[model samples]
Target: MRSRNSRLGTAAALAGLIAGTAMAGCSTTGMDASDTITIALAANPTGAFDPYRNREFGISEVAPFTHDSLLYKTPEGEFVSRLAATWKADNTSATFTLTPGITCADGSALTAKDVAAAINFASDAANASWAYGYYTPTAPLTAVGDDASRTVRVTVAQPYGYLLDTVGLLPILCAAGVKDPDSLANRSNGTGPYVVSAVSTGETIELKRRDDYAWGPDGTTVADAPATVVFRQIADETTAANLLLSGDVNIANVSGPNSDRVRAAGLDSADAYTAAAWLNFNQREGRATSDRRVREALVHALDFKEVIAVSTNTHGVAAEGLLVTEPAVCPTNAVAGVLPGQDLERAAKLLDEAGWVLGSDGKRVKDGVPLTLGLRYWTDRSELERPTAELLAARWKAIGVGIEPIGENVGGLVKTLYQTGNFDVYLLGWDLRLGSQFIPYLSGPLPPRGQNFMALDNPEYVKLSAEANATTPPQGCDLWGKAERAVVNDFDLVPISNRVTSLFYRGVTGQLTPVEPTSLRATQ
Candidate 1:
């Protein structure tokens, strides 16, 4: 592993930062910052705008602007009504009161039946939703049109107490868009405040504000916004930050040393929490990390506090569980001290106990095989991911373990890490922009078929999760809390950083959360 070189761009960013700061104070601008909110994205969407098929992180960030959901949640996981003006549900079913007279981008009026069809589409077993397990209907979900009642009724074939939690985040689609999702690669038809005008792969997506749109969450409307919103894929974090500073772009999501440098340049910012970075151990046979003890030992080997400080620029804390930071459905401290502290001696002892003895090179070996872990991480993901991998390698090395760090682009991660099962341990982090309680990890599809990279098969977790899904409110959330604790406490996955970082932008009015996909932030 290469030595920790901070942010890879911050040191060189001094000049760019200075120039950016100086430029920010000037009014020599050409673009109408008031008429357009240009966002500098780290990467382009993988392709298309199909809610069922688009699992790319970049796309998730953009979907909300082009679609509406039955409900909404703040980044903190606080639930609120959305398309469904009033929703009431039981363990097995839900009924939604449709907002009167809302229209789709197609100029078609929305109905309760439309919302129900969306829920069914998203929950299909063949769907590619990242949270497929959470949204997958245990039984067929059906929608009944009841215009006289001014409501749409959806019945979950089986028990589903927390169905709305996952259902609420789904972007409701028109019948045509749902039938031919590929058509949305460059177009859209939804109830959102904007319609995707054009999609330039690897470059930009242009959106024009919907003058007819008036139904926002909680009966709100977009009173202040640019007539057009432009999303630019800059790829480089420093470049994005510099662009934002130079008024070339109004908003950008940047983190680590880059985030520090940009904010130091005096830009307005919004801090929002994202899911924690984590380590997923491949438990398939012949992989060294299959042993649970080894996983726990590795967790104990690193001083996460030190790693996080360098990685997040003090924007994060050591994570306790999957629900890292939250206005979450279930908030608890299951992670506090549940993990073994950074104790090399303890790690060494655990390795010794596990039959991995230190050899002449001071690296642990079992039988004739050395304990070398293959670590794969996303390339150019953030300023933190690469350095974090290096620091992690160093920490494990200090405890007589060997790790080979490999860099893969975001697109390559799913193929290499999950499909090919190419690595023993891989770096993964979920952006819980929409809270689904992470039920997929316990009972979702395994690699090649889905994103369950860990392949964790815990029956207790499944039972608890099932029970939780069939219950309501705090009861369901409370059960999920137990399941999360069970998996995490067993050291199935290692936590890295749980952070709330500020998105530095200009002329944006409403607050936004990195985790809530449907939370649209408009201009002031």
Candidate 2:
């Protein structure tokens, strides 16, 4: 756990890691007898293989190997060159020097033309993906200068503080895949470390090392290592952990009761964090939660620390804000003291003032209507969603409000929670790949326009989010912190925990393949 000061010092620390790359160089020669490394993923790719569109969390395990980006972020949170040789930027425009001779899997040359094409294709609104909101260019990002120059110029409508961070992701694809992404199901069209050699739909995904891949991050080549990689989907947590222990699976991500079992087994493990799990309130009309006071009451009624402890088996943090991931330009503790404490007296009073009064049936009522909330939670996403919802129902019941829990399946979570807007209260979360991914939710259009599931239409927030984007990091990112504070102050969002996923490894050589994919290589 690095401190704020250490986070500030990460640029230098990460530089040293990049500078001393040769000593840690990985080899592809020592082929294992099995010649493959198998990992147990949490779920199958629940959506289609459009690299630019909205997809499931399982995509994280697959995409990094198939698509290479211009830049890569070191685990310590600093930018390192990947396909790009050098980068220089200002508030409005940034330039990337595409490395000399990188090639896509089809043996075609990767050029500045390919980079510009991928950005333009994804930035189009008709793509119906999060990238539509993620990359908002007044004019599309284009390739500027001749062949010797080799630079892609990024121009935002205004100053975008996190532009550098955003470009580090987005999976830089060649023209072929961008033209016909559907045809990429069985082939390798990317410039990444591995090629998709085999796919069995939901059962398995296999990738073979790309021998010609020399353009990895931090001046290190990883494509030659670990002859083969395989991802196996095991829906049950206990079963996944057992597979790792029995050598049927080399690695597994375990949480709740299974995490303790993995740790007691004495296998290697590391900490992984994702987006903060939030209690999202649907502010649409015809819902009792449409009232601001009702939303605030729901926030304080639950015992959050205890709820997180019970749900995570004491392996979670009470999230102070949405930006819980570390080493960022914005101060991580900005929302520290803003969250409302769990106080039953305050919750009861707030509901009463909002015209919801206790009745003979023991539930609060407003104009003969009982104050009951329909709660939706993912049934298969985690071992904790149902229990967390049950605990919330119990706590809210003690405060005179009733909650009816509806279990949401994995394949239908997005449609059920965001599209239908059928639930008053729901348990939801996201993975903030570049930190600024949270912007779309604050500004509305719900699912299609953005992931504004709460249907928030805060003009001040919209203004602040835009203002934040118009500045560079440290300054612009600080504005984002202020906007998030405004969101928490209203109690429209209640964060229970910053999810902690523990990855256990048995025969995994060197660094384990991350829960969030990275440019890491095997030592064996």
Candidate 3:
């Protein structure tokens, strides 16, 4: 499933990299070695800690610390063993051999039966897991485990590409956590390097390192990891930066103006293209954006280059496609010439042909109704979202289009998009890693039924995506590229810009993975 806070969660993955210069000669020094690491979350977590159920950005931000998957995907895109020491897959089936001596946080031996149960639970549609559509194949599948052989086998009836990539990310729960799922609402029971020690609801989540964790990626253990890692909720970017500089926090994601401040403070930082911020028009019936002409016109109404500068504070690049994460499954540019460039004249002409006549008061009118559109955006996602909304509103207004910029927090925005469906347009970023993850958001039943929040019904995209999903990667990359082009050429969503999320770190050193900190060692 597309994380509810994909934009923020994915960006936070790169937020753990510590610079060597900033941490020089500080290895195991000033701060308590056991209490040295502190991370910042953009917002308070409101969902359960259940990896399969909670897709909140805050939940995802801390997932790597609390959960362990079957395998780990390195920043280089190589799949390494975590719980499963060896794994092999075909188009329709996959087998994983669990590592010996792997145990749960509760000290119970992690057997193949536990792994199979987690898979069966997540893959079952009856459980209504969002992971079913995004992480697992939509087709029927079965998982069986043999404890004696320490093997768990998964088989599908139809050809399903990305079988390994999908299952690799499934955070395997212990037998207890799987049996009493409700107990995982605020606690964790995984074999990861950390365990949830304390939670103050929306304020903070404290994790203590698990010294027994020895089956990490590449056999890394918690030997050098901080004894305690705290994720504190600090909403303001400037505040987060200040805390990092003051040594109140060891890691924080600083974007916009504050990023420069953190950099000047001698903090070591790394940037990742975490998400693609874009404009998604609600294409349900009766919406003005339902007309292809209107969608194209609106896309042509603004200079995206300028929008990118304003929205990202000059730290973003023009988006190439929907997949922004590095080492994308399909490394093809599907958006080069597919989307229309800025053309005010063309926009006006299209709007005119669509029956939105320019009015005397400088607004479009069609059939006695004013052409006003509600442009919704998340207020707290970035310091730039508001200005970006204002910029788009100003540009669209110049073309006789009335835009009402509506600001909401992440929760409010999700409710409006998925449940209320009250807005005409939405401006947000989707932090996605795979091409298949885009299908549920781009097509399928609308909110309360499925996650197709935009209500898009592109027949071409639907057809191409189906063909692409049936084939494995490398072989399916061509079909995936065509499917992405179909979405872009049709202007289903305007790819605005790709933000470079700069994560600032201080007084810490460790292996920096694309998604989170692994084998972290506190230097200060």
Each model's TM-score? 0.85, 0.86, 0.92
Q: Identify the runs in model 3 with alpha carbons over 4 angstroms from their true place.
A: 1-29, 57-59, 513-515
Write candidate 3's Cα lDDT for 259-350 as tens digits: 88889878997776644358888988899999989989988998888988988889778888778665678866777988878999999999
Clashing pairs in 3: none
Question: Can you write out model 1's per-residue Cα lDDT over 1-524, one digit (the tens) per residue?
Answer: 01111111110000011112222233223645346666665555566666566555213456667788877766445667778788887777777787887888878877766666666666665665553554444445666757666687777777876667666566778767777777776677888887877666666677778876666767777655567767676668777777877777766667767778888888887665554357778877777777877988898888878877755668777665565434455655557767677887777888888999998888889998899999987664565668778888988888888889997765676577556878887776554311244666545677556556677776777778677767666766677767777777777766677655556776565554342222344443
Candidates' lDDT values, in order? 0.65, 0.64, 0.76
RMSD (CA, Å), each prediction: 6.1, 6.8, 4.5
What is the descending TM-score order? 3, 2, 1
Winner on TM-score (1 vs 3): 3
Query: Candidates ranked by lDDT, best first?
Result: 3, 1, 2
lDDT of 2 by residue, 389-489 (tens): 88888988988898898886555665765567788987765434333556666655666655677877777667776677677766666687777777777
Best candidate per lDDT, number?
3
Cα error, residue 427 of model 3, in Å, equals 1.0
List the candidate 2 regions with Cα displacement exceeding 4 Å. Answer: 2-34, 57-59, 134-148, 185-188, 275-277, 433-435, 510-524
Q: Name the lDDT value of residue 179 in candidate 2.
A: 86
1 or 2, which is superior by TM-score? 2
